[model samples]
Every structure is written in C-alpha cells, then in structure tokens.
Target: MNQVIRGLSVTTFFYMVTLWASFALFHAIFDKPFDHDWDLSGNFIGLFMVSVPYIAYGLILRHLENRPVRRAVQVSLLTVVCERVSIYWIGSYFAANGYGNPIPLQFIRGEAAPYFSIPYIFIGGIVSVLLCVAAAGVRWRKS
Candidate 1:
C-alpha cells in the first residue's frame, strides 16, 4: 500500500510536470495553447492523458527491469498508442452522445483538432509514443 501510494505520487508529479512542459513548448512554437479549455472536464482529461504515460512506464519498469532499452521503448510506445486509441474511441462516443460535463471529447476536438482528425491519427500516435518513451527515460533516470 505504501509503495503503491509512493508510486502514484511520483508518477502524478512527473506526469503533470512533463505535460505542462510539453504544453509550454507547443504554445511557444505554435503560439497557441496545447489545450484551450481549463474547466473541470478538460483538466480531468488532461490528467488522465498525462497519467497514461507515467503509468505505462512505471509498470514496465516494475515488471521488466531486465529488458533492454530498445525493447522497453518498443513496449512503452505500443502501450501509449493503445491508450491513445482507446481514449480517442471513448472521446468519439462522448462527442456523439453529447454526454458528460462540458465533455472532454469536445476539448480534444477543439484543442488537438489537427491531431484528432482522421488523417492525423498516425502522427498523433507517433507523437504519443515518443512522449511515453521520453517519460520512460525520465523515470529510468530517477529510479
């Protein structure tokens, strides 16, 4: 229990820091916020998205400590891609139904419009994979 709490705390801290850093970089480069809506729903979704990479890297680091960097990177990338796809599917459902408070799907569409579009799934997936890989690197160094 103590270990779980510690892991979650560390993961959450890293996730938020990395997410904000990424957002800041994107904002500086594009002159626009990585995400526009700062409401409860939007914040929740952002939390979830950021946590995905941290959790993925944490789990891999926990179970596959002996794995080589190439293999670890591959697994982490796959995990992030899968997670992003699942999130997109859930987002699509919410968008279609007009459900949830303010709806995270709408925020995804509004802020990550280019990335969320049909033609950009691969690009987004690659970017997510890279982000996860980088997060894994940070976790590895910290541990």
Candidate 2:
C-alpha cells in the first residue's frame, strides 16, 4: 500500500515536471507556447505521448526489480492507459467550463495545426526515457 502510494506520487511528479519542461523547450525553440485549445489536438496528443513513458518508468521501478520483464512491461502499459483516461476526463472537465481561457470552439477551423505535432511528442518521449533511465542507472550505481 505504502509502496504503491509512493510510486504513484513519484511518477505523477516526474511526469508533470517533464511535461512542463517539454512545454518550455517548445516555447524556447519554436517560439510558441503550448496551445490551451482542442483545435490543436496534436499538441495535447503530443503531451500524452511524452507523459506515458515516465509513468511507465515509475511502474517499472515499483514492480520490475524482481519480476519478469514481460510482466513489468504489461503493468507499465496498463498504467499508461489508466493515466491517459484520467487525463481525458480532466481535459473534458476543463473544456466544459471554458477553463484555461480556451478559445471559443466556434472560432476554430478544421485545418490541422502544427502545435504539438507528432514529431515533437516522439522527441519528448525519447528524451524522457533517456533521462529516467539515466537517473535510475545513477541511483543504482550509487547504492
């Protein structure tokens, strides 16, 4: 019980930090902030892509040390799916209330926007995985 709570807390914190850093990176490099509107679904999708691996890393740490790799992967994938569902629910809540100063839906045209494109999401995921793996390796070596 305690372990699970600790794992979740650590995972959530890491994921949020990574998300913010990725947003900042995009802002710095692309000279644009992450959009707060759904017409830019690509951006939100990209954020999710970047987030899942970090969440998986936390689950892997909690359950993988003594378990088979296959089992660990399965559990990690499940954790990612659960996190995505929760994110969707939260997004819907915010959208319903016009939170984050979302642009009116009526104003959005159907053209696919470049904000939060797939490539950025993939880059974020790769960077996150590398960072998490490196951190874990360092901790292991220290101990």
Candidate 3:
C-alpha cells in the first residue's frame, strides 16, 4: 500500500514536471515563434510522443524493483491514463471541483478538448501505452 502511494507520487510528480517542460517548449517553439494559431492538439499529441520513453523508463524501473514483468507493464499502462487525466484536469480539480470558475480549465476544457478532435483521451492514452510496451518487448527480444 505504501509502495503504491510512493510509486504514484513519483510518477505524478515526474510526469507533471515533464509536462510543464514540454508545454513550455511547445509554447515557445510553436505558439510564439511564428505567432500562428496555437495548436493545442499538436502540443498534446507531441507530448504523448515525448512521454512514451519516460513511461517505459518507469516501467523498467519497476521491473528492476523485482515486480513481475507483466505487473509492471500493466501498472505502467494504467499510469498513462493517470498521467493524462492529471495533465488535463489537475489544476481545475485543485481550484474548486469545477464550481469555482477555474482559469486552467479554460485552456483544458476550451482549448485542449475541442482541439483534440478525438473524443476520448482515454483511448489515446491506452494506445500510447501499448506502443511503449510493444517497443519494449521488441527491444527485449533483440537483446
């Protein structure tokens, strides 16, 4: 139980930091460079691409910790959903459960959601995790 809580803390904190860095880079490189339309979907998709290896790294660490390989993979995949949800709504949740008129939710609900095109982030999150696992499996087979 304690280990799970610690693991969740580590994953959440690591992901949040990476997410901020990613958003900063994306904002600077895309949003400000040409001053074109801010493509929030592009940022979200690109971040998922960037996050894959980090997700794999966490899974590998879990493996190193003597958790079963399958369990590590399973939890890592679940963490993808967790990470995405946190990215999307953590600020709003902190503000006041969507009743307090959160500023962050404006970007999240207004910009990101409509920009995503795909109606379900959960599906995308699962697919991203599967891609990471597939890559890891192939690498393990080769080495």
Candidate with top TM-score is: 3
Off by over 4 Å in 1: 1-16, 28-64, 99-107, 111-114, 117-120, 123-143
lDDT of 1 by residue, 1-143 (tens): 45434444554455556656656655676575545533433344444454465556545554554543444355545554555677687776766676643566454566453234443355545655565555445543554
**Scored by CA lDDT, what does every candidate get?**
0.51, 0.48, 0.52
Indicate whether candidate 1 or candidate 3 has the larger TM-score.
3
Q: Which residue pairs collide in model 3, if any?
A: none
Instruction: Encode model 2's per-residue lDDT on 88-140: one tens digit a residue.
Output: 45555665676643432222211222333334534654554554444333333
Candidate 3: segments with Cα more than 4 A from true spot: 31-46, 53-56, 81-107, 111-120, 135-143
Judging by lDDT, tell me the better candidate of 1 and 3: 3
The list of candidate 2 runs beyond 4 A from truth reads: 36-64, 68-71, 98-143
Over 1-143, each residue of candidate 3 has an lDDT whose tens digit, in order, gives: 55546555665666666555665666675665312343564455455544654465555554455543444466556666675666566655644555444666445544443223234365566665565455434434344
Overall local distance difference test of candidate 2: 0.48
Q: Candidate 1 or 2, higher TM-score? A: 2
- Work out candidate 2's RMSD over C-alphas: 7.4
Q: Best by lDDT, which number?
A: 3
TM-score of 1: 0.41
